[model samples]
Target: METFSIHPIGYVRERDGSKVLEVLPEYRPALDKLDEWGHVVSVWWFSGSDNPDTRSILRQTRPHQSSPGEAGTFATRSPRRPNPLGLTVAKIDRVDVEQGLVVIDRHDALPDTPLLDIKPYSPGSDRVEAPILPEWAAHWPKSREESAVFDWAKEDGKA
Candidate 1:
């Protein structure tokens, strides 16, 4: 097996007054030019799910009951996987270089989550005009604004 090394550049400080990505003092200068972008794609570790059992799970029944049948780890976005990683595109509310903070409008990552990388979100490369999706998830929110009000529990067959 091949081995690799990775380190976190920062941590998500969710309870320190407000949720924000706080870069390490040494890496603070790295956030020098990230303000021009309206949004950022954050890559972070799913530390909560990084364990032997979760990493060993290669297949399982779908979490959302609405989605039928079993699925391989790669086919689903479940936290339990060989590598517990999370990617989220968050709206950049503000960037304080002095504080090494990048305040985002929203992020699902928990407090102290390790940030792997941050990239400016580019619509040209990230957006798809017409993409295909499973029939069960075809009715999902079309935009972030819509997602705020979308009934997730209902879609997941919990309601």
Candidate 2:
């Protein structure tokens, strides 16, 4: 197999209870005009889950109560896959291109997580008007705003 290299262009940070993506000085230029977008797709590394055992996991049994009984790692957003990469669409709260900082509404990645890349969330390409979903997750929130107040614990079988 061919190997490739990946590097962090920034790190996720938490300041005053807000999630922030602090781009490294060298990568600051990349943030130019990023603030024009209302939302961005953040690609980050699941550093905590990166291990031989986790990487070897190919399947998960009932990873989520609202998910299928069993699913391949790829089918579900399991961090324990061949590559522990995380992708999230976060609403932009603020962006300081000069300071190389992007304050986002929310993200699932932990503080200090390595940020790989950021892409503008273009509705033209990213949105699906009538995407199909599995029966189990059909009841989930339809948008990120709704998800913010959603009863996620119930989906995890914790509530």
TM-score each candidate. 0.91, 0.95
Compose the digit string of candidate 2's lDDT tens values, residues 1-159. Answer: 898899999999999999999999999999999988999999999999999999999998887886767889888887889999999999999999989999999999999999999999999999998888888889888888899999777777323
Prediction-by-prediction clash tally: 0, 0
Which parts of model 2 are misplaced by more than 4 Å? 157-159
Best by lDDT: 2
Across 1-159, the per-residue lDDT of candidate 1 in tens digits comes to 897798999988774456698888888888888999999988999999999999999986765666767768787778889989998888888899888899988787898899999889999999888888788778888877798788777755234
lDDT of 1: 0.84
Query: lDDT of each model, Cα atoms only?
Result: 0.84, 0.91
Q: Please state the error at residue 41 of candidate 1 in Å.
A: 0.6
Q: In model 2, what are the clashing residue pairs, if there are any?
A: none
